[model samples]
Target: MKKHTYILASLLLVSGIALAQKENIKRANKLFKMKAYTQAAKTYETKERTQEVLQNLADSYYYNTSLQKAIETYRELFVKYGDSIDIEYHFRFAQALKGVKNYKEADEHLSKYYNKPVNTLEFIEANNKITPHNFKLKEIVNEGSSSDFGLSFYGENKVVFASTRNTENPSYAWNELPYLDLYTATLTNSNTLINVQPFPEAINTSLHESNAVFTKDGKTMYFNRTNSTRKKTDEARIAHIKIYKAELINGEWTNVTALPFTSNSYSTEHPALSKDEKTLYFASDMPGTFGSFDIYKVAINDDGTYGEPENLGETINTKHREQFPFISEFNVLYFSSIGHQGYGGLDVFRSNMVNGGFDKPVNLGNIINSNLDDFAYVIKEKDNVGYVSSNRTGYDRIFSFSREENPLTKYLVEGVVQDKNSKKLLPGALVEIINQSNKTIKDTVVGENGYYVFKLEPNKLYKIRGTRQAYIEQELEFLTGNYGKSHNIDINLESLVSVEERIHQNEKGELHVQLDKIYFNYNTSEITNEAAKTLDVLVDLMKKYPSMKVEIAAHTDARGSEQYNLNLSKQRAALVLEYLVNQGINKNRLKSVGYGETRPLNKCIKEGICDDEEYDINRRCEFTILK
Candidate 1:
């Protein structure tokens, strides 16, 4: 009986321990759902390495930008639960791999996740060419500063930003950093910050504060602050952030109040105001959010009340985080997104307002973006300079940049292809742009508008060629010396048949090179002197249009055996292609075809039926434009 009681006690203890672990996991999931990744990660680390626990733990690390830890945990999750894992895990795992520049491994997972090949290195290389600016980063040094971000224009020469530099503030559970406070400093010409000081207590509270935007008068300001009390939602307790408005009166900031749309259960942060101060833009994860967070805006009425908060919609928001919106004076919307395709983490993107709606967003590219969190982009269009915050160096740091137009995208050549004699748009004409190295950089068939455009690099020589079937190819050679400029070159293609009365296109669209019949040694495929002279004209035409692609076709009279004629005609056609290739035409531009006696000219059928003059018409060489 004693032995049985001891066994029962041990079983009960094991059950109790299992129940306790289950409760802990429940708590950790609540914290994670509340965006408290740091705390959730700690709790998850104490649990057994089950699939659920491991996935949540790895995700926590990824969300916190602890990429190395996330990679290791994800690897374990895959090894144990590879078949059961969701497709999204593969995407997150690939992103963690990219954060460490392991592109080869990342691509393998990305291919599986997206169900298509993804070449990260190739994308980075190409993106560098198109990215608008190269940034020279300088980390603003502030003594005793742990982390700082969200730098914005204050006055003529002053700057305002948020920082967690104070040790006296309460520690934030999100990252173990102090609660953020608004701070001001003098921005020197050298992009250095000096005389850094915190804002008045009215603006800097015991809770978090950040993302301050000021009006032109510098007297009105809008900023973000965390709610003092935590509100319980269905999942967890959350201290939601809100935007507050304050006025600088009599050298003091007063009348601090939260905006009308702010809710205790949802976050509304990263406030920005338009140039006229009539529109307010912010980020939120409220009821209508399509994802974790989205950019929103509202109209500021003349009476100081606000209209309904409007979500930026699908054009700007995706099923992932899109935040840190900054509207420029030119009405360009700049924001950060993790949902869009990027190098890795949050990448800055710009969308111009067109037709009174936001257009598609364009990634700022690799120079200003890294494989880590890069957000809080603010720019001054007039000065061609901007400020961005990034945690790429392991701590949030402010970087100043001077933007110049990308040389690769600075020059462009655009033109219309038209018939030279008719002056009418020639749709479906082939246009190609060649570089100095004689390499075709771009090739396209003109649309209904007969238009084509090629982005070019500055200080380079280029050739633009226009060609169509039965038309003599025309080329225009020019140099792009002026950067950030557009050049127009209209192309007019002349008909080859019009230029030479003997040249004609058959029903199959092949341009025949008609010449008087000359006697060739009974059966040799060698080029005779008369044929050489006739072929020289084609060589010159090919040289004039470098991008022209042509096929040399040879036909034979229906006199010899079919096999014999086919072989002889193939040799003759090859001879013509060789001649053109030897005369400086690219071999790739020339192709050879032999129709033999199968396609006879006119009604000439058999050797005995037609006279020599009639049979001679069937023996010919033709050149057809392939592109």
Candidate 2:
């Protein structure tokens, strides 16, 4: 009985395989025709599936859905059979690899056919994050209007966008696009916008026109337009739109024309053009879409026309529509979408092509995106400011976003470097600025008067190394905390160490330490935000050597009453000492000292320098380590 049951089960399995085999070939062909590659791929996977069936299975799955499975099937089927075929499958298979983010391998294959442009958007974006700060956002591009969309650099001249302005319905509260057209504003050489206006004649139609990208040479333009509508044909229900391109001939734009490879029955628009005018990105609801209106890329062929569109894949697309693509000069793609998780409505996002696939798309975040509809953004290379078109305001307007480049401290570092021997200013010496990470962040040549200035955030340890060829390098460290008062700490560096003397090695050497000056504001004990930043540098060094003791001192320029100045300086030093104590430094290791008018370096008419700024030279405070 057990043997009979095993035989029966084997028969059933064999019958199922046989049934799968016969129709599998038929199903593969049917799906190939209908472009349902993913569903047909399962049947074609059986061992009994025919060569004709599996080859079609590979092509269908690969081309229609993605290249990952297509590569596998093509490699397997190609191995089984030599390359005698009715169609060129390998070329598309390579493009499929590129479509799926297997770029290096795809490039290996693409080199056999095409030379890809160098994508530098990733580098541009990386440096965008690596560099310093940004200017503040100032004003709106449009004070009124509610229909602006899509912004582009107008070829070293201005920014062009889509708007429903100054059109028919001139008295209408708003001029929305039925025949929407191109508008522009001048962009200053510094990337500022001015003298905004609209493009006339050929570029502007009575229909919807947006998604404009210019060729690098600035003579050609590719954009989207709604040609005509069809009724319920492949997701178009008398409401489908299309895309088009136009050329700037001589000094005028030619009439717009529809793009090639678009079917009459499907909805397509939102075109993104490559800098070389050879590649494009557009949105379509064509057959075999992974989700609603997936983003697709197409390459320009030898004849100067577009090839079959390749879907950008699931990485940058979601079930929601992704449109208005902007490929930065560096190949970083910026697009707006409703699909991915966002704060609300549509948000602008940027993605970089990395390792043959895309890095995760980054939400330009709250700084650029708003809860209301935000779309159509373009970034300037090597700049932190970008222009975005949105209806976030009560009306449609262009908003400029100033991106903060770095998040460092905010205190100004000002001091003088003097020669220890003659107490004369050292002119033209390089002042090297070092951050806490020990990276040489910046270097400035000292002015002819031997003064240097640097700005940093409060709460950091900075090392200032002053140098000249004939003189030994002099290094000074400072911890700037929250001191409400101004600083007048002038540093005087010494000569080259004498050969017989390892002077700096012995921390106890006389010239090893000296106080140039102490700084304070007029009658203030509260620390300024600038002082807070510089004090942090001091905190780090003192913590580096737990046994070091220091005296916090205050001095007054020779202008005030002797007794009052002494008390005021003492109170000021005590306030600073209290701050250090609160920062966890031992109180027993610190002392407060006040030196009134008695220590003025400059001899004055009445034992003081005569003028306020010079008089300010003596009113200061600082810390000196006591060995």
Compared with the true structure, model 1 gives a TM-score of 0.65
Residue 545, model 1: Cα distance from true site in angstroms: 42
* lDDT (tens digit, per residue) of candidate 2 on 185-243: 77555545467666666776655677677877778787776654544533223435677
Model 2 stretches astray by more than 4 angstroms = 1-139, 169-179, 187-197, 233-237, 406-627
Error of 2 at 400 (Å): 1.9
State residue 492's C-alpha deviation in candidate 2, in Å: 36
Q: Write the per-residue lDDT of candidate 1 for residues 1-627, one digit (tens) a residue.
A: 999999999999999999999999999999887787899999999999999999999999997889999999999999999999999999889989888889899889989987999898888877776565666666666666879999999988889999999889998877888989999999877677899999999999899999999999988899999998889977778899999999999999999999999989889999999888999999999999996899999999999999999999999999789999999987889999978778888899988665566877877887678888899999998788889999899989998887876766568889899988989898999999886657676899999999998877666678898888778778789998655689999999888778876567788777765655533344678888898888788777677656668888888888879999899889889988888788888899989998888888678877688888788888877776665
Cα deviation in Å at residue 413, candidate 1?
A: 6.0
| Candidate 2 TM-score to native | 0.43
Q: How does residue 539 of candidate 2 score in lDDT? A: 62
**How many clashing residue pairs appear in each of the predictions shown?**
0, 44
TM, every model = 0.65, 0.43
Which residue pairs of candidate 1 clash?
none
lDDT of 2 at 597: 65
lDDT of each: 0.86, 0.64
